[model samples]
Target: MTLFTGLAAVAHAQGMSVSSSAFADNALLPAIHAGAGDCGGTNTSPPLEWKNLPQATRSVVIKMTDPDGAKGGGVVHWIAYNIPASVLSLPAGAGDKSGDQITVGKNVSGAAAYRGACPPVGDTPHHYVITVTATDLDPGRLPPGLDAAGLAVALAGHTLNGSTIVARYGR
Candidate 1:
């Protein structure tokens, strides 16, 4: 089986909690892939589709972070802000563009792009949680490089709702 497929198997066996319509629950991207490094075979953003959002949702915020990252504070792999609520899906490679309506934020590597999971070889699998939040305001106002804490501060009272999808991978 391909690496992606292998990763999916692990997620399934591990009981990851994510929306069934999102990539973590889909069969296509069995694993999460990011840009850069030997572990980064592809720069795709993993297609994402969601529903059951509230009516006040003007935009959505998508973020992928490795809570079990090698470092202590965890790692941010991907962040896309100001996604119009009308948009139901983010096609693979959506993060390829810079400063688009779908803003890309800084990852763990300090770059404004996705850095896929590439744990030290032979290490245990790591869990990556991909979360989507429906906001009452536009995500465009938020600037890039705002880590989780920064994001939480900016989203103080504007968050209408949210959801999550989790996937696992390791090398």
Candidate 2:
């Protein structure tokens, strides 16, 4: 067993696991070099690739979030679901409605989109954690516009496995 300190300490204690290809713990955001702002910093979603999913997975769900947000402890930046099991990657800006093999849900902006990193000024860099959950249910069951809570209810007793990647964004 391992332990994480600070803001992420709670999540670690709760048994949420995380990993990434472009970034890691205490790692900087590569999108910054590509000209994207931290959360709310730009409008483009970062490109991501993942693998090593659990064998029981029938569908995959992806979500982008900034745990450090305005007055709510954390905020949802993007929610995407119904990803086919064959998909293993998402290009930058793929969180938009145009992305293939997936559907985007309503964001904090209430526009069913992926809002980029835009942390408060002068604050420590915020962590944008992108997670992929593998589920045993059919992807077609999930309708668009499901909030996190709704998605959770829909996924009850269905999650088989999951993976995650984290990036830090700050000015």
The TM-scores, one per candidate, come to 0.77, 0.77
Off by more than 4 A, model 2: 1-25, 31-41, 98-100
Model 2, span 1-171: residue lDDT tens: 354455365553344344545566558776532224433345766667766666566778888878887754898878888887777777766766634578788877677777777777787888877888888877666888887778889889998777677788776
How do the residues 87-156 of candidate 1 rate in per-residue lDDT, one tens digit apiece?
A: 7777666764455568777676667776666655675666777888888877567876776667778789
Q: Which prediction has the highest lDDT against the true structure? A: 2
Q: What is the C-alpha lDDT of each candidate?
A: 0.68, 0.71
Which candidate tops TM-score? 2
Clashing pairs in 2: 38-117, 38-118, 39-117, 39-118, 40-116, 40-117, 40-118, 41-117, 41-118
Superposition TM-score, candidate 2 onto the true structure: 0.77
RMSD of 2: 7.8
